[model samples]
Target chain A: MTITDELLRNNEQYAAQFSGPLPLPPSRHLAVLACMDARIDVYRALGLNEGESHVIRNAGGVVTEDGIRSLAISQRLLGTEEIILIHHTDCGMLTFTDDGFKQSIQDEVGIRPPWAAESFPDPFDDVTQSINRIMASPFIPQKGSVRGFVFDVATGKLIEVTV
Target chain B: MTITDELLRNNEQYAAQFSGPLPLPPSRHLAVLACMDARIDVYRALGLNEGESHVIRNAGGVVTEDGIRSLAISQRLLGTEEIILIHHTDCGMLTFTDDGFKQSIQDEVGIRPPWAAESFPDPFDDVTQSINRIMASPFIPQKGSVRGFVFDVATGKLIEVTV
Candidate 1:
Protein backbone atom coordinates (compact mmCIF):
# COMPACT_ATOMS: atom_id res chain seq x y z
CA MET A 1 0.00 0.00 0.00
CA THR A 2 1.00 3.57 -0.59
CA ILE A 3 1.83 5.61 2.50
CA THR A 4 -1.47 7.44 2.03
CA ASP A 5 -3.30 4.14 2.29
CA GLU A 6 -1.37 3.32 5.43
CA LEU A 7 -2.41 6.65 6.92
CA LEU A 8 -6.01 5.91 6.01
CA ARG A 9 -5.74 2.76 8.09
CA ASN A 10 -4.41 4.88 10.93
CA ASN A 11 -7.35 7.21 10.49
CA GLU A 12 -9.69 4.28 10.99
CA GLN A 13 -8.11 3.64 14.37
CA TYR A 14 -8.41 7.34 15.19
CA ALA A 15 -12.08 7.44 14.20
CA ALA A 16 -12.83 4.41 16.33
CA GLN A 17 -11.64 6.18 19.46
CA PHE A 18 -12.76 9.65 18.46
CA SER A 19 -15.35 11.73 20.29
CA GLY A 20 -18.03 14.00 18.90
CA PRO A 21 -17.46 17.53 17.62
CA LEU A 22 -16.36 20.35 19.87
CA PRO A 23 -17.22 24.05 19.85
CA LEU A 24 -16.27 26.28 16.92
CA PRO A 25 -14.22 28.93 18.76
CA PRO A 26 -10.90 28.28 20.45
CA SER A 27 -11.36 27.73 24.16
CA ARG A 28 -8.18 29.53 25.23
CA HIS A 29 -8.78 32.32 22.75
CA LEU A 30 -5.29 31.75 21.34
CA ALA A 31 -3.80 31.25 17.90
CA VAL A 32 -0.34 29.86 17.19
CA LEU A 33 1.74 30.06 14.03
CA ALA A 34 4.64 27.66 13.76
CA CYS A 35 6.92 26.05 11.19
CA MET A 36 5.63 22.90 9.53
CA ASP A 37 8.55 20.90 10.85
CA ALA A 38 8.10 17.17 11.17
CA ARG A 39 9.29 16.90 14.75
CA ILE A 40 7.49 19.77 16.45
CA ASP A 41 4.04 18.74 17.59
CA VAL A 42 2.51 22.09 18.57
CA TYR A 43 -0.24 20.64 20.77
CA ARG A 44 2.12 18.60 22.94
CA ALA A 45 4.74 21.30 23.06
CA LEU A 46 2.26 23.88 24.24
CA GLY A 47 0.30 21.45 26.45
CA LEU A 48 -2.76 22.43 24.46
CA ASN A 49 -5.91 20.43 24.85
CA GLU A 50 -7.96 19.70 21.79
CA GLY A 51 -10.15 22.71 20.88
CA GLU A 52 -8.15 25.10 23.04
CA SER A 53 -6.40 26.98 20.23
CA HIS A 54 -6.15 27.46 16.50
CA VAL A 55 -2.89 26.24 14.97
CA ILE A 56 -1.60 27.89 11.83
CA ARG A 57 1.61 26.54 10.29
CA ASN A 58 3.72 27.09 7.20
CA ALA A 59 7.21 26.54 5.79
CA GLY A 60 9.40 28.86 7.85
CA GLY A 61 6.67 29.93 10.26
CA VAL A 62 7.17 33.39 8.80
CA VAL A 63 4.24 35.77 8.82
CA THR A 64 3.49 35.96 5.15
CA GLU A 65 0.41 37.56 3.65
CA ASP A 66 -1.48 34.32 4.02
CA GLY A 67 -0.56 34.28 7.69
CA ILE A 68 -2.02 37.76 8.03
CA ARG A 69 -5.22 36.44 6.50
CA SER A 70 -5.31 33.53 8.92
CA LEU A 71 -4.58 35.73 11.93
CA ALA A 72 -7.21 38.25 10.87
CA ILE A 73 -9.80 35.52 10.60
CA SER A 74 -8.68 33.99 13.87
CA GLN A 75 -9.17 37.23 15.78
CA ARG A 76 -12.14 38.64 13.87
CA LEU A 77 -14.41 35.64 13.46
CA LEU A 78 -13.20 33.09 16.00
CA GLY A 79 -12.60 35.27 19.10
CA THR A 80 -8.91 34.32 19.37
CA GLU A 81 -7.02 37.11 21.15
CA GLU A 82 -3.53 35.93 22.06
CA ILE A 83 -1.09 35.09 19.27
CA ILE A 84 2.00 32.88 19.48
CA LEU A 85 4.60 32.45 16.75
CA ILE A 86 7.09 29.58 16.76
CA HIS A 87 10.19 29.20 14.63
CA HIS A 88 12.45 26.29 15.40
CA THR A 89 16.22 25.82 15.31
CA ASP A 90 17.63 23.89 12.33
CA CYS A 91 14.77 24.71 9.94
CA GLY A 92 14.92 23.87 6.23
CA MET A 93 14.32 27.52 5.47
CA LEU A 94 17.74 28.16 6.97
CA THR A 95 19.38 25.94 4.35
CA PHE A 96 19.00 28.24 1.32
CA THR A 97 18.36 31.76 0.20
CA ASP A 98 15.14 32.87 -1.46
CA ASP A 99 16.96 33.92 -4.62
CA GLY A 100 18.75 30.60 -4.92
CA PHE A 101 15.56 28.58 -4.35
CA LYS A 102 13.64 30.65 -6.86
CA GLN A 103 16.46 30.27 -9.38
CA SER A 104 16.51 26.51 -8.94
CA ILE A 105 12.78 26.27 -9.54
CA GLN A 106 13.06 28.62 -12.50
CA ASP A 107 15.89 26.58 -13.99
CA GLU A 108 13.93 23.36 -13.63
CA VAL A 109 10.47 24.55 -14.66
CA GLY A 110 11.52 27.35 -17.08
CA ILE A 111 9.27 29.72 -15.11
CA ARG A 112 10.23 31.63 -12.00
CA PRO A 113 7.87 31.66 -9.06
CA PRO A 114 6.72 35.18 -8.33
CA TRP A 115 6.28 34.61 -4.64
CA ALA A 116 9.12 34.89 -2.13
CA ALA A 117 10.55 31.55 -0.97
CA GLU A 118 10.86 33.14 2.53
CA SER A 119 14.06 31.35 3.40
CA PHE A 120 15.67 32.95 6.41
CA PRO A 121 19.17 32.65 7.79
CA ASP A 122 18.22 33.16 11.42
CA PRO A 123 15.07 31.86 13.07
CA PHE A 124 15.24 34.37 15.92
CA ASP A 125 15.56 37.31 13.57
CA ASP A 126 12.72 35.97 11.50
CA VAL A 127 10.58 35.54 14.57
CA THR A 128 11.18 39.12 15.67
CA GLN A 129 10.43 40.43 12.20
CA SER A 130 7.35 38.23 11.88
CA ILE A 131 6.03 39.69 15.10
CA ASN A 132 6.62 43.14 13.69
CA ARG A 133 4.69 42.16 10.60
CA ILE A 134 1.75 41.18 12.75
CA MET A 135 1.92 44.26 14.97
CA ALA A 136 2.00 46.49 11.89
CA SER A 137 -1.01 44.90 10.22
CA PRO A 138 -4.31 46.77 10.64
CA PHE A 139 -6.09 43.59 9.61
CA ILE A 140 -5.12 41.86 12.84
CA PRO A 141 -7.17 43.41 15.64
CA GLN A 142 -5.43 41.77 18.59
CA LYS A 143 -1.80 42.76 18.96
CA GLY A 144 -1.81 42.71 22.72
CA SER A 145 0.10 39.44 23.07
CA VAL A 146 1.81 38.44 19.84
CA ARG A 147 4.73 36.59 21.36
CA GLY A 148 7.52 34.93 19.35
CA PHE A 149 9.73 31.98 20.22
CA VAL A 150 12.49 29.80 18.87
CA PHE A 151 12.02 26.13 19.69
CA ASP A 152 15.23 24.25 20.31
CA VAL A 153 14.93 20.97 18.43
CA ALA A 154 17.36 19.05 20.63
CA THR A 155 15.77 19.77 23.98
CA GLY A 156 12.24 20.52 22.74
CA LYS A 157 12.29 23.68 24.84
CA LEU A 158 10.80 26.87 23.53
CA ILE A 159 13.11 29.85 24.09
CA GLU A 160 11.36 33.17 23.87
CA VAL A 161 12.80 35.51 21.26
CA THR A 162 13.24 38.77 23.15
CA VAL A 163 14.55 41.42 20.84
CA MET B 1 0.24 34.52 34.26
CA THR B 2 -0.82 35.04 30.69
CA ILE B 3 -1.79 32.00 28.62
CA THR B 4 1.58 32.21 26.87
CA ASP B 5 3.31 31.97 30.23
CA GLU B 6 1.19 28.97 31.13
CA LEU B 7 2.14 27.29 27.86
CA LEU B 8 5.79 28.01 28.62
CA ARG B 9 5.38 26.09 31.87
CA ASN B 10 3.83 23.27 29.86
CA ASN B 11 6.85 23.31 27.53
CA GLU B 12 9.10 22.61 30.49
CA GLN B 13 7.24 19.40 31.17
CA TYR B 14 7.29 18.48 27.50
CA ALA B 15 11.04 19.07 27.41
CA ALA B 16 11.62 17.01 30.56
CA GLN B 17 10.52 13.85 28.74
CA PHE B 18 11.23 15.07 25.25
CA SER B 19 13.40 13.27 22.75
CA GLY B 20 16.30 14.70 20.82
CA PRO B 21 16.15 16.46 17.49
CA LEU B 22 14.77 14.25 14.77
CA PRO B 23 15.82 14.37 11.15
CA LEU B 24 15.04 17.53 9.21
CA PRO B 25 13.32 15.68 6.39
CA PRO B 26 10.14 13.74 7.06
CA SER B 27 10.86 10.06 7.48
CA ARG B 28 7.56 9.01 5.89
CA HIS B 29 8.06 11.32 2.89
CA LEU B 30 4.53 12.70 3.33
CA ALA B 31 2.99 16.14 3.75
CA VAL B 32 -0.46 17.03 5.04
CA LEU B 33 -2.26 20.34 4.71
CA ALA B 34 -5.24 20.70 6.98
CA CYS B 35 -7.42 23.36 8.58
CA MET B 36 -6.30 25.40 11.57
CA ASP B 37 -9.35 24.24 13.52
CA ALA B 38 -8.64 23.51 17.16
CA ARG B 39 -10.57 20.22 17.12
CA ILE B 40 -8.47 18.47 14.50
CA ASP B 41 -5.12 17.34 15.79
CA VAL B 42 -3.42 16.29 12.55
CA TYR B 43 -0.92 13.96 14.17
CA ARG B 44 -3.40 11.95 16.25
CA ALA B 45 -6.05 11.99 13.53
CA LEU B 46 -3.69 10.61 10.89
CA GLY B 47 -2.04 8.24 13.40
CA LEU B 48 1.30 9.74 12.50
CA ASN B 49 4.36 9.35 14.63
CA GLU B 50 6.43 12.43 15.32
CA GLY B 51 9.04 13.10 12.62
CA GLU B 52 7.01 11.13 10.07
CA SER B 53 5.38 13.89 8.07
CA HIS B 54 5.42 17.64 7.50
CA VAL B 55 2.13 19.12 8.68
CA ILE B 56 1.09 22.41 7.07
CA ARG B 57 -2.05 24.14 8.24
CA ASN B 58 -3.85 27.42 7.71
CA ALA B 59 -7.31 28.89 8.16
CA GLY B 60 -9.16 26.84 5.53
CA GLY B 61 -6.62 24.25 4.39
CA VAL B 62 -7.39 25.39 0.89
CA VAL B 63 -4.52 25.19 -1.64
CA THR B 64 -3.69 28.85 -1.79
CA GLU B 65 -0.45 30.15 -3.32
CA ASP B 66 1.11 29.86 0.14
CA GLY B 67 0.09 26.22 0.30
CA ILE B 68 1.74 25.66 -3.08
CA ARG B 69 4.95 27.23 -1.75
CA SER B 70 4.96 24.93 1.26
CA LEU B 71 4.21 21.86 -0.88
CA ALA B 72 6.87 22.72 -3.42
CA ILE B 73 9.46 23.11 -0.68
CA SER B 74 8.30 19.85 0.92
CA GLN B 75 8.74 17.94 -2.33
CA ARG B 76 11.85 19.64 -3.70
CA LEU B 77 13.96 20.07 -0.59
CA LEU B 78 12.41 17.69 1.92
CA GLY B 79 11.60 14.77 -0.45
CA THR B 80 7.94 14.45 0.45
CA GLU B 81 6.23 12.63 -2.41
CA GLU B 82 2.60 12.29 -1.42
CA ILE B 83 0.24 15.14 -0.57
CA ILE B 84 -2.95 15.00 1.48
CA LEU B 85 -5.34 17.92 1.62
CA ILE B 86 -7.98 18.20 4.33
CA HIS B 87 -10.98 20.46 4.74
CA HIS B 88 -13.53 19.87 7.44
CA THR B 89 -17.23 20.19 8.16
CA ASP B 90 -18.55 23.02 10.38
CA CYS B 91 -15.74 25.20 9.08
CA GLY B 92 -15.77 28.93 9.80
CA MET B 93 -14.98 29.46 6.14
CA LEU B 94 -18.30 27.96 5.15
CA THR B 95 -20.21 30.43 7.28
CA PHE B 96 -19.42 33.46 5.11
CA THR B 97 -18.62 34.46 1.55
CA ASP B 98 -15.39 36.12 0.39
CA ASP B 99 -17.15 39.30 -0.54
CA GLY B 100 -18.98 39.53 2.76
CA PHE B 101 -15.88 38.94 4.85
CA LYS B 102 -13.87 41.47 2.88
CA GLN B 103 -16.69 43.96 3.07
CA SER B 104 -16.97 43.55 6.81
CA ILE B 105 -13.26 44.21 7.17
CA GLN B 106 -13.54 47.17 4.87
CA ASP B 107 -16.42 48.58 6.87
CA GLU B 108 -14.46 48.28 10.09
CA VAL B 109 -10.93 49.09 8.91
CA GLY B 110 -11.81 51.34 5.93
CA ILE B 111 -9.53 49.24 3.70
CA ARG B 112 -10.51 46.13 1.75
CA PRO B 113 -8.17 43.20 1.88
CA PRO B 114 -6.59 42.46 -1.46
CA TRP B 115 -6.63 38.75 -0.84
CA ALA B 116 -9.69 36.56 -1.20
CA ALA B 117 -11.10 35.40 2.13
CA GLU B 118 -11.33 31.99 0.39
CA SER B 119 -14.73 31.23 1.79
CA PHE B 120 -16.63 28.45 0.03
CA PRO B 121 -20.19 27.10 0.06
CA ASP B 122 -19.27 23.42 0.17
CA PRO B 123 -16.30 21.61 1.67
CA PHE B 124 -16.54 18.79 -0.86
CA ASP B 125 -16.46 21.09 -3.85
CA ASP B 126 -13.65 23.17 -2.39
CA VAL B 127 -11.61 20.07 -1.69
CA THR B 128 -12.00 19.04 -5.34
CA GLN B 129 -10.96 22.48 -6.53
CA SER B 130 -8.01 22.54 -4.13
CA ILE B 131 -6.82 19.20 -5.48
CA ASN B 132 -7.13 20.60 -8.96
CA ARG B 133 -5.02 23.57 -7.87
CA ILE B 134 -2.22 21.19 -6.96
CA MET B 135 -2.62 19.27 -10.21
CA ALA B 136 -2.40 22.50 -12.20
CA SER B 137 0.69 23.89 -10.47
CA PRO B 138 3.99 23.64 -12.35
CA PHE B 139 5.96 24.27 -9.15
CA ILE B 140 4.83 21.13 -7.36
CA PRO B 141 6.78 18.22 -8.86
CA GLN B 142 4.70 15.38 -7.48
CA LYS B 143 1.08 15.24 -8.57
CA GLY B 144 0.96 11.47 -8.30
CA SER B 145 -1.18 11.26 -5.19
CA VAL B 146 -2.83 14.57 -4.47
CA ARG B 147 -5.85 13.32 -2.57
CA GLY B 148 -8.36 15.56 -0.83
CA PHE B 149 -10.73 14.74 2.01
CA VAL B 150 -13.34 16.37 4.20
CA PHE B 151 -12.98 15.56 7.88
CA ASP B 152 -16.33 14.98 9.57
CA VAL B 153 -16.10 16.86 12.85
CA ALA B 154 -18.88 15.04 14.63
CA THR B 155 -17.90 11.46 13.70
CA GLY B 156 -14.14 12.08 13.51
CA LYS B 157 -14.01 10.31 10.18
CA LEU B 158 -12.43 11.48 6.95
CA ILE B 159 -14.58 11.15 3.84
CA GLU B 160 -12.58 11.39 0.63
CA VAL B 161 -13.88 14.09 -1.67
CA THR B 162 -14.10 12.41 -5.05
CA VAL B 163 -15.68 14.63 -7.62
Candidate 2:
Protein backbone atom coordinates (compact mmCIF):
# COMPACT_ATOMS: atom_id res chain seq x y z
CA MET A 1 0.00 0.00 0.00
CA THR A 2 1.01 3.63 -0.55
CA ILE A 3 2.31 5.55 2.46
CA THR A 4 -0.68 7.85 2.17
CA ASP A 5 -3.08 4.94 2.41
CA GLU A 6 -1.13 3.55 5.32
CA LEU A 7 -1.37 6.91 7.08
CA LEU A 8 -5.06 7.16 6.23
CA ARG A 9 -5.66 3.85 7.90
CA ASN A 10 -3.67 5.01 10.91
CA ASN A 11 -5.73 8.18 11.07
CA GLU A 12 -8.87 6.10 11.20
CA GLN A 13 -7.67 4.79 14.54
CA TYR A 14 -6.47 8.25 15.59
CA ALA A 15 -9.89 9.76 14.91
CA ALA A 16 -11.60 7.14 16.98
CA GLN A 17 -10.10 8.76 20.09
CA PHE A 18 -10.57 12.30 18.84
CA SER A 19 -10.64 15.39 21.03
CA GLY A 20 -11.92 18.79 19.94
CA PRO A 21 -10.19 22.05 19.04
CA LEU A 22 -7.69 24.07 20.99
CA PRO A 23 -7.66 27.88 20.98
CA LEU A 24 -6.17 29.80 18.07
CA PRO A 25 -3.30 31.33 20.05
CA PRO A 26 -0.74 29.00 21.55
CA SER A 27 -0.93 28.80 25.30
CA ARG A 28 2.80 29.21 25.83
CA HIS A 29 3.17 32.14 23.43
CA LEU A 30 6.07 30.40 21.73
CA ALA A 31 7.13 29.23 18.27
CA VAL A 32 9.92 26.83 17.38
CA LEU A 33 11.76 26.81 14.07
CA ALA A 34 13.49 23.49 13.57
CA CYS A 35 14.64 21.02 10.95
CA MET A 36 12.20 18.64 9.24
CA ASP A 37 14.36 15.70 10.35
CA ALA A 38 12.29 12.61 11.08
CA ARG A 39 14.36 11.73 14.14
CA ILE A 40 13.67 14.93 16.03
CA ASP A 41 10.28 14.74 17.66
CA VAL A 42 9.94 18.40 18.66
CA TYR A 43 6.97 17.84 20.91
CA ARG A 44 8.30 14.78 22.74
CA ALA A 45 11.85 16.12 22.80
CA LEU A 46 10.93 19.49 24.24
CA GLY A 47 8.07 18.39 26.50
CA LEU A 48 5.44 20.32 24.55
CA ASN A 49 1.82 19.35 24.70
CA GLU A 50 -1.01 20.16 22.32
CA GLY A 51 -1.85 23.87 22.09
CA GLU A 52 1.44 24.83 23.77
CA SER A 53 3.53 26.21 20.92
CA HIS A 54 3.86 26.50 17.17
CA VAL A 55 6.58 24.32 15.61
CA ILE A 56 7.79 25.66 12.26
CA ARG A 57 10.11 23.33 10.41
CA ASN A 58 11.99 23.09 7.11
CA ALA A 59 14.94 21.18 5.70
CA GLY A 60 17.76 22.79 7.64
CA GLY A 61 15.47 24.78 9.88
CA VAL A 62 17.44 27.80 8.75
CA VAL A 63 15.58 31.05 9.39
CA THR A 64 15.14 32.00 5.77
CA GLU A 65 12.90 34.79 4.45
CA ASP A 66 9.88 32.50 4.38
CA GLY A 67 10.68 31.27 7.89
CA ILE A 68 10.98 34.85 9.07
CA ARG A 69 7.65 35.58 7.44
CA SER A 70 6.05 32.68 9.30
CA LEU A 71 7.53 33.84 12.59
CA ALA A 72 6.37 37.38 11.89
CA ILE A 73 2.84 36.23 11.37
CA SER A 74 3.02 33.89 14.34
CA GLN A 75 4.16 36.65 16.66
CA ARG A 76 2.45 39.69 15.16
CA LEU A 77 -0.93 38.18 14.42
CA LEU A 78 -1.17 34.97 16.40
CA GLY A 79 0.34 36.18 19.73
CA THR A 80 3.44 33.94 19.86
CA GLU A 81 6.28 36.07 21.16
CA GLU A 82 9.26 33.90 21.93
CA ILE A 83 11.14 32.08 19.16
CA ILE A 84 13.31 28.99 19.50
CA LEU A 85 15.52 27.91 16.64
CA ILE A 86 16.74 24.32 16.56
CA HIS A 87 18.99 22.50 14.11
CA HIS A 88 19.86 18.87 14.44
CA THR A 89 23.13 16.98 14.09
CA ASP A 90 23.60 14.65 11.09
CA CYS A 91 21.16 16.71 9.02
CA GLY A 92 21.03 16.26 5.25
CA MET A 93 22.00 19.91 5.01
CA LEU A 94 25.45 19.01 6.31
CA THR A 95 25.89 16.67 3.34
CA PHE A 96 26.44 19.39 0.71
CA THR A 97 26.92 23.06 -0.02
CA ASP A 98 24.26 25.23 -1.65
CA ASP A 99 25.97 25.21 -5.02
CA GLY A 100 26.65 21.49 -4.85
CA PHE A 101 23.01 20.69 -4.01
CA LYS A 102 21.73 23.02 -6.73
CA GLN A 103 24.08 21.42 -9.24
CA SER A 104 22.84 17.98 -8.23
CA ILE A 105 19.27 19.11 -8.79
CA GLN A 106 20.23 20.69 -12.11
CA ASP A 107 21.89 17.46 -13.22
CA GLU A 108 18.81 15.42 -12.28
CA VAL A 109 16.04 17.78 -13.46
CA GLY A 110 17.82 19.59 -16.35
CA ILE A 111 16.95 22.89 -14.63
CA ARG A 112 18.47 25.07 -11.93
CA PRO A 113 16.03 25.86 -9.17
CA PRO A 114 15.61 29.51 -8.23
CA TRP A 115 16.09 28.73 -4.53
CA ALA A 116 19.15 27.97 -2.41
CA ALA A 117 19.66 24.91 -0.24
CA GLU A 118 20.76 26.98 2.79
CA SER A 119 23.03 24.12 3.72
CA PHE A 120 25.38 24.28 6.70
CA PRO A 121 28.50 22.40 7.68
CA ASP A 122 27.85 22.57 11.38
CA PRO A 123 24.31 22.48 12.69
CA PHE A 124 25.42 24.25 15.91
CA ASP A 125 26.72 27.27 14.05
CA ASP A 126 23.67 27.19 11.85
CA VAL A 127 21.43 27.43 14.89
CA THR A 128 23.24 30.54 16.08
CA GLN A 129 23.08 32.09 12.64
CA SER A 130 19.38 31.28 12.39
CA ILE A 131 18.77 32.90 15.77
CA ASN A 132 20.61 36.00 14.61
CA ARG A 133 18.54 36.07 11.46
CA ILE A 134 15.37 36.02 13.49
CA MET A 135 16.67 38.64 15.91
CA ALA A 136 17.66 40.94 13.07
CA SER A 137 14.38 40.69 11.22
CA PRO A 138 12.34 43.91 11.45
CA PHE A 139 9.16 41.85 11.38
CA ILE A 140 9.71 39.99 14.64
CA PRO A 141 8.58 42.26 17.50
CA GLN A 142 9.67 40.23 20.52
CA LYS A 143 13.36 39.67 20.17
CA GLY A 144 13.81 39.98 23.89
CA SER A 145 14.38 36.27 24.45
CA VAL A 146 15.58 34.23 21.51
CA ARG A 147 17.40 30.91 21.85
CA GLY A 148 18.99 28.33 19.58
CA PHE A 149 19.93 24.69 20.07
CA VAL A 150 21.63 21.84 18.30
CA PHE A 151 19.73 18.65 18.99
CA ASP A 152 21.81 15.46 19.00
CA VAL A 153 19.87 12.95 16.97
CA ALA A 154 22.00 10.09 18.27
CA THR A 155 21.28 10.72 21.91
CA GLY A 156 18.12 12.83 21.75
CA LYS A 157 20.19 15.39 23.61
CA LEU A 158 19.76 19.13 23.10
CA ILE A 159 22.74 21.41 23.53
CA GLU A 160 21.97 25.10 23.78
CA VAL A 161 23.76 27.41 21.38
CA THR A 162 24.65 30.80 22.77
CA VAL A 163 23.82 33.26 19.97
CA MET B 1 12.71 30.57 34.06
CA THR B 2 12.97 30.89 30.29
CA ILE B 3 11.28 28.35 28.05
CA THR B 4 14.68 27.30 26.80
CA ASP B 5 15.79 26.43 30.28
CA GLU B 6 12.62 24.51 30.86
CA LEU B 7 13.09 22.55 27.67
CA LEU B 8 16.77 22.00 28.35
CA ARG B 9 15.92 20.43 31.66
CA ASN B 10 13.36 18.30 29.92
CA ASN B 11 15.93 17.25 27.33
CA GLU B 12 18.33 16.33 30.08
CA GLN B 13 15.86 13.75 31.26
CA TYR B 14 15.08 12.69 27.72
CA ALA B 15 18.73 12.12 26.86
CA ALA B 16 19.23 9.91 29.87
CA GLN B 17 17.16 7.14 28.31
CA PHE B 18 17.77 7.98 24.62
CA SER B 19 19.14 5.43 22.15
CA GLY B 20 21.33 5.93 19.09
CA PRO B 21 20.53 7.53 15.72
CA LEU B 22 18.10 6.50 13.05
CA PRO B 23 19.33 6.38 9.44
CA LEU B 24 19.83 9.59 7.47
CA PRO B 25 17.22 9.07 4.76
CA PRO B 26 13.61 8.41 5.69
CA SER B 27 12.90 4.69 5.52
CA ARG B 28 9.40 5.20 4.17
CA HIS B 29 10.57 7.37 1.24
CA LEU B 30 7.90 9.95 2.14
CA ALA B 31 7.77 13.67 2.89
CA VAL B 32 4.80 15.46 4.42
CA LEU B 33 4.21 19.21 4.56
CA ALA B 34 1.87 20.09 7.40
CA CYS B 35 0.87 23.01 9.63
CA MET B 36 2.78 23.91 12.81
CA ASP B 37 -0.43 23.97 14.76
CA ALA B 38 0.38 22.81 18.30
CA ARG B 39 -2.68 20.63 18.43
CA ILE B 40 -1.57 18.37 15.61
CA ASP B 41 1.03 15.80 16.65
CA VAL B 42 2.52 15.06 13.23
CA TYR B 43 4.28 11.92 14.49
CA ARG B 44 1.54 10.45 16.64
CA ALA B 45 -1.34 11.47 14.39
CA LEU B 46 0.34 10.04 11.31
CA GLY B 47 1.70 6.97 13.12
CA LEU B 48 5.17 7.83 11.93
CA ASN B 49 8.18 6.46 13.78
CA GLU B 50 11.65 7.90 13.83
CA GLY B 51 13.33 7.75 10.42
CA GLU B 52 10.04 6.95 8.71
CA SER B 53 9.18 10.21 6.91
CA HIS B 54 10.18 13.83 6.68
CA VAL B 55 7.61 16.20 8.17
CA ILE B 56 7.98 19.74 6.88
CA ARG B 57 5.95 22.30 8.76
CA ASN B 58 5.34 26.05 8.87
CA ALA B 59 2.60 28.42 9.99
CA GLY B 60 -0.05 27.14 7.58
CA GLY B 61 2.13 24.47 5.94
CA VAL B 62 1.52 26.33 2.70
CA VAL B 63 4.17 25.23 0.25
CA THR B 64 6.30 28.31 -0.44
CA GLU B 65 9.36 28.74 -2.64
CA ASP B 66 11.72 27.70 0.13
CA GLY B 67 9.49 24.77 1.01
CA ILE B 68 9.75 23.66 -2.60
CA ARG B 69 13.49 24.10 -2.35
CA SER B 70 13.53 21.80 0.65
CA LEU B 71 11.40 19.24 -1.14
CA ALA B 72 13.69 19.44 -4.15
CA ILE B 73 16.68 18.78 -1.96
CA SER B 74 14.80 16.04 -0.11
CA GLN B 75 13.88 14.25 -3.34
CA ARG B 76 16.90 15.00 -5.51
CA LEU B 77 19.57 14.70 -2.85
CA LEU B 78 17.74 12.20 -0.68
CA GLY B 79 15.44 9.38 -1.82
CA THR B 80 11.94 10.47 -0.77
CA GLU B 81 9.43 9.83 -3.59
CA GLU B 82 6.00 10.74 -2.24
CA ILE B 83 4.73 14.15 -1.09
CA ILE B 84 1.80 14.82 1.23
CA LEU B 85 0.54 18.31 2.00
CA ILE B 86 -1.66 18.76 5.08
CA HIS B 87 -3.40 21.81 6.54
CA HIS B 88 -5.66 21.82 9.56
CA THR B 89 -8.98 23.40 10.63
CA ASP B 90 -9.18 26.45 12.98
CA CYS B 91 -5.73 27.48 11.79
CA GLY B 92 -4.31 30.81 12.87
CA MET B 93 -3.87 31.53 9.17
CA LEU B 94 -7.65 31.48 8.87
CA THR B 95 -7.96 34.12 11.62
CA PHE B 96 -6.84 37.04 9.42
CA THR B 97 -6.37 38.22 5.86
CA ASP B 98 -3.03 38.86 4.18
CA ASP B 99 -3.60 42.60 3.89
CA GLY B 100 -5.06 42.80 7.37
CA PHE B 101 -2.13 40.94 8.97
CA LYS B 102 0.40 42.97 6.99
CA GLN B 103 -1.29 46.14 8.17
CA SER B 104 -1.19 45.00 11.76
CA ILE B 105 2.52 44.30 11.54
CA GLN B 106 3.09 47.61 9.77
CA ASP B 107 1.20 49.47 12.48
CA GLU B 108 3.12 47.78 15.29
CA VAL B 109 6.62 47.44 13.85
CA GLY B 110 6.74 50.64 11.72
CA ILE B 111 7.61 48.56 8.64
CA ARG B 112 5.49 46.35 6.45
CA PRO B 113 6.84 42.84 5.88
CA PRO B 114 7.72 42.06 2.29
CA TRP B 115 6.31 38.58 2.72
CA ALA B 116 2.64 37.69 2.65
CA ALA B 117 0.87 35.97 5.53
CA GLU B 118 -0.55 33.45 3.02
CA SER B 119 -3.80 33.33 4.90
CA PHE B 120 -6.64 31.20 3.58
CA PRO B 121 -10.41 31.14 4.08
CA ASP B 122 -10.92 27.42 3.67
CA PRO B 123 -8.07 25.11 4.61
CA PHE B 124 -9.32 22.42 2.20
CA ASP B 125 -8.92 24.77 -0.73
CA ASP B 126 -5.64 25.99 0.73
CA VAL B 127 -4.35 22.43 0.86
CA THR B 128 -5.28 21.93 -2.81
CA GLN B 129 -3.61 25.21 -3.76
CA SER B 130 -0.50 24.30 -1.82
CA ILE B 131 -0.41 20.90 -3.52
CA ASN B 132 -0.68 22.62 -6.90
CA ARG B 133 2.10 24.98 -5.90
CA ILE B 134 4.37 22.04 -5.08
CA MET B 135 3.37 20.13 -8.23
CA ALA B 136 4.00 23.19 -10.40
CA SER B 137 7.47 23.72 -9.00
CA PRO B 138 10.08 22.43 -11.46
CA PHE B 139 12.41 21.24 -8.72
CA ILE B 140 10.19 18.54 -7.23
CA PRO B 141 10.87 15.17 -8.93
CA GLN B 142 8.07 13.23 -7.24
CA LYS B 143 5.19 15.51 -8.11
CA GLY B 144 3.22 12.74 -9.81
CA SER B 145 1.86 11.22 -6.60
CA VAL B 146 1.27 14.40 -4.58
CA ARG B 147 -1.73 14.45 -2.22
CA GLY B 148 -3.33 17.07 0.02
CA PHE B 149 -5.40 16.76 3.19
CA VAL B 150 -7.33 18.96 5.57
CA PHE B 151 -6.84 17.57 9.08
CA ASP B 152 -9.63 18.22 11.54
CA VAL B 153 -8.28 19.84 14.69
CA ALA B 154 -11.37 18.82 16.64
CA THR B 155 -11.86 15.26 15.51
CA GLY B 156 -8.28 14.38 14.50
CA LYS B 157 -9.84 13.25 11.23
CA LEU B 158 -8.07 13.68 7.90
CA ILE B 159 -10.20 14.63 4.89
CA GLU B 160 -8.21 14.13 1.72
CA VAL B 161 -8.44 16.91 -0.83
CA THR B 162 -8.62 15.50 -4.38
CA VAL B 163 -6.25 17.87 -6.07
lDDT winner among the candidates?
1
Model 1 residue A107 lDDT score: 97
Please provide, for model 1 over A62-85, each residue's C-alpha lDDT reduced to its tens digit, 9 standing for 90 to 100: 899899999899999999999999
Runs with alpha carbons beyond 4 Å of true place in candidate 2: none
- Native-vs-model 2 lDDT? 0.85
Overall lDDT per candidate, in order of appearance: 0.93, 0.85
Name the candidate that leads on TM-score. 1
DockQ of each: 0.89, 0.79
Native-structure RMSD, model 2: 1.3
